[model samples]
Target: MTQELIRATIETLEMVTVSSLFSVLLGLPLGVLLVLSRPQGLRPRPALYRALDAIINVFRSLPFLVLMIMVFPLSRLITGRATGTTATIVPLAVAAIPFVARIMEQSLLEVDGGVLEAGLASGAKISQLVWTVLIPEALPALVNGVTITVINIIGNSAMAGAIGGGGLGDLAVRYGLYRREPVMLYTSVAVIIVLVQLVQWLGGYLERRLRRDGKVTASA
Candidate 1:
């Protein structure tokens, strides 16, 4: 039981890490596009923004359980298996993409409009404006978003056990539920809670560090 719990913890971490990375990679760009396409955005295209917004909303609207099943075929096609730790990565990422995109959109939008205007006035390209001004300005908030996303991914990964996605959730189900081991169930829940607290602490630490560094840099 000890060994299995350890393994399950590792699997859960792997799934959460990989899925969050993919979410940021794809969702960050989508979010940038979403903001840029907004009516008051850098490039303002209402139609494009609306379309993108709708797509994100549709995906976000689906329950994670349903989304997991819905993506099984795609998972099979990509990972060559529809259920397991690795295969679960696909659905986790898909579920997180829209979520991360929205997080980034909100973070980026919070950047001071004056900064964006100044970048524009300085003849900076849109890419430059984003890379230099917007992202930097919103770095702390973006970190917060990432932290939230990581926690959410961790939670979803627990649910992934329903389909044999190997992790603490699966371990809990197999032994705790199936074998009727109350100890295993309670232990699994305790471990998950501990993991979440650790992640939350780490994220808060990073955000505070970033904010402090940004302040120092600006003052310098």
Candidate 2:
């Protein structure tokens, strides 16, 4: 049981971490594009914005369970198999991309409009404005958004396990549900809760640090 628990924990962490990283890598740029291409943005293109918006909405609307099944073929192509912790990263990342993109959009949008204007007025290029003003101002919000995404991924990873993705969820389904081992089920649930709480705490800590640093920078 201990070995099983350890293996499940490791798998769950790997799935969540890798998926979250890739999601951020892809989603941050996508979110930025969504924002910049929107009406009255850095480079307004109503058609492009609408297209991106629609695509993100479509993916976001799909339930993760359905999305997981839908992506099996792609996952197989990417990982050479559709089942396992590594292969699970494909579906998980696909689901998380739009999820994180929406969060990133909201976070970036929360930045003060005045700051963006100042950057523009100062002859800052769009990229410069984003890197220097928009992102810095939105850093705290972005951190919070990432925190939320990570927690969501943790939950999703478990669900992935339900379909043989392999994690705590797999253990729960295999032993707890299939073999009638209630203890394993309960233990898995507890572990997930603990992991979430720790993530939340760490996120809070980082946000506070960023806020404090921002204040210090401003004061100086």
Candidate 3:
């Protein structure tokens, strides 16, 4: 039981890590574009902003379980399977894209406009302005947003096991629930609680450190 639990925990970690990577890599650009194209943004385009907004809304509105079912075909097509730790990453990442995008958009929106305007006045191109001013100014907030996304993704990943998407969820369902093993169930729950607590603490520490360093840099 211990060995199996350890294996399940590793699978959970793998799913979370890879999905978080994909979600962040793709979502960050969509988020940046959202900020750039908002009605009163660096380059306002209501039509584009609305379209992006709708797309993100549709994804975010769907419950993760439903989204998992909806994404099964895509997962099969991409990974040639939809029931294992590796294959489950497809839907997990897909479901997280919009979530990460919206979080990142919010983070970027919180950046001070003065920095962006100063960049623009200095003849910075849109790309340069985003790279130099918006992202830098928003880095601390962005990290917090990412921390939130990761925590949510971990929960979603566990839930994915309802569909045989392997992880601690699979362990809980198969051995704990199905086999009538109350101890297994309790252990699984305990491990999940521990993982969440650890992530929360680590994320808060990093965010605080980043903010402190940012303040020091500014003061210097």
Candidate 4:
């Protein structure tokens, strides 16, 4: 039992890590694009902004369970099957990208206009201002946003288990609910709690460190 649990835990962590990486990779750029193309942004294009915003809203509004089922066909197409960690990555990444985008938009929006002006005053190009000024100024908030996104992904990964994406949650559902194994259920639940706490703590610590670095001021 112990060995099985350990294996399950390792596999589940691997899936979560992969899902989280994809989410960040896809979402961060989308978020930056959203912010950069907004009305008050460096280059404003109403049509483009609205179109992207609509896409983000469409994905963000859907419940994870519904989205999971809705994307099954796409998942199968991408992974060549619709069961296991690889298959689950499709929906998990799909669901997370818009979420991360929204969070990232908000984080970048919090960046100080004054800092941007300063960058422009210093003859920095628009791209340079964004890369050096906006992103660094928003680093702490963005870190927090990323932390939130990862935690949400962890929860969603559990839902993935229902569709045969095996993880600790799947273990709980199969052994605890189906087979009435109370010990297994409780153990999985405990593990999830610990995982959540660790991520939260690490996120908070990183945010604090960035905040103290003083490289960029909140109003800069």
Off by over 4 Å in 2: 213-220
For model 1, name the residue pairs that clash.
none
lDDT of 3 at 84: 92
Question: Against the correct fold, how does model 2 do in TM-score?
Answer: 0.95
Tens digit per residue, CA lDDT, model 2, 1-220 = 8998999999999999999999999999998888899897889999999999999999999999999999999999999999999999999999999999999999999887888998899999999988888778888889999999999999999999999899998988898878998999999989999999999999998888788854554321
Candidate 3: tens digits of C-alpha lDDT, residues 1-220: 8999999999999999999999999999999999999999999999999999999999999999999989988889998997799989998899999999999999999988887888999999999998888887787788898888888988998899867888888888887777989888888878888888888888887778778854544321
What's the CA error at residue 73 for candidate 1, in Å? Answer: 0.8
- Check candidate 2 and list the clashing pairs: none
Q: Which candidate order results from sorting by lDDT in descending order?
A: 1, 2, 3, 4
Please give the lDDT score at residue 196 for candidate 1. Answer: 91
Clashes of 3: 0
Model 3 / residue 92 / CA error / Å: 0.9
Cα TM-score of candidate 1:
0.95
Ranked by TM-score, top first:
1, 2, 3, 4
| lDDT of the candidates, in the order given | 0.92, 0.91, 0.89, 0.86
Q: Assess candidate 4 and give its TM-score to the true structure.
A: 0.94
